[model samples]
Target: MSSTNRASSDDEFIVVREILSRLGDKWSVRVIHEAAGEPIRFTDLKRKIERSTPISSRVLTRTLKQLERDGLVTRRVYPVVPPRVEYRLTELGQQFLHHAQEIMGWTMEHQTAFETARREFEAQTTEQ
Candidate 1:
């Protein structure tokens, strides 16, 4: 293959890997899932996410910023006595969520198989 084509392929691979790294992050997925539907205040999002997994305020803030930078989430500040900031998913984010949900469904369907595979691997390793 041509060097130019190889360079382009390498660049595309890097971009895709970066995107996957961002979306595959635990905090990023949690934030995206919680931020779906209506716009939610930062505090509320934190509270909801914490119910499932504990996360620090700083980490949440950083994750939201990253998601915003990736164009997956939008942050809006409301003028008030105490400033309020809310987050909502963009159209692209919704599309991503749809795909994620499908993958999640597949995982659930094969959860038992996954568990069995893990058990078999562990048993074999222990016998070594």
Candidate 2:
């Protein structure tokens, strides 16, 4: 790890946690993945993400803004009928997808073990 990443403190750890927490939301990941291929209008994105999480307009706005501020997404506004707004991934966001895919692969590979562990854990708790 780099010196900066190696520096240890509760606050620094919090920063790392914050970064992941923002992307860890179901809506955020779904939004990013859905919009990855091309720029998606606000309503289109709202529909796609809401299909999975029922995200409120207010919350979606906040999530998109957070992603934009984090340099993961770019929002563009167009002048037209009622105006048009679209969002797409930035290079860093595109790169992050690779890590996400790796996580997916790991989950798939260990799914059986994960289920077994969960069952064992629940059984042990019940026995207590």
Model 2 residue 45 distance off true place after TM-score fit, in angstroms: 1.3
TM-scores for all candidates? Answer: 0.87, 0.79
Model 1 lowest lDDT segment of ten: 15-24
lDDT for position 57 in model 2? 89
Tens-digit lDDT track of model 1 for 26-124: 888778888999999999999999997899999999999988988899999999869999999999888878787888889999999999999999999
How far does residue 4 in candidate 1 sit from its true spot (Å)? 1.9
Clashes of each: 0, 0
Residue 60 error, candidate 1, Å: 0.5
Over the stretch 1-128, how does candidate 2's per-residue lDDT look in tens digits? Answer: 66665766666888778778855676677767877888999899889876766878888898889889988899999988899999999998887766777877899999999999999999999999
Checking candidate 1 for backbone clashes, the offending pairs are none
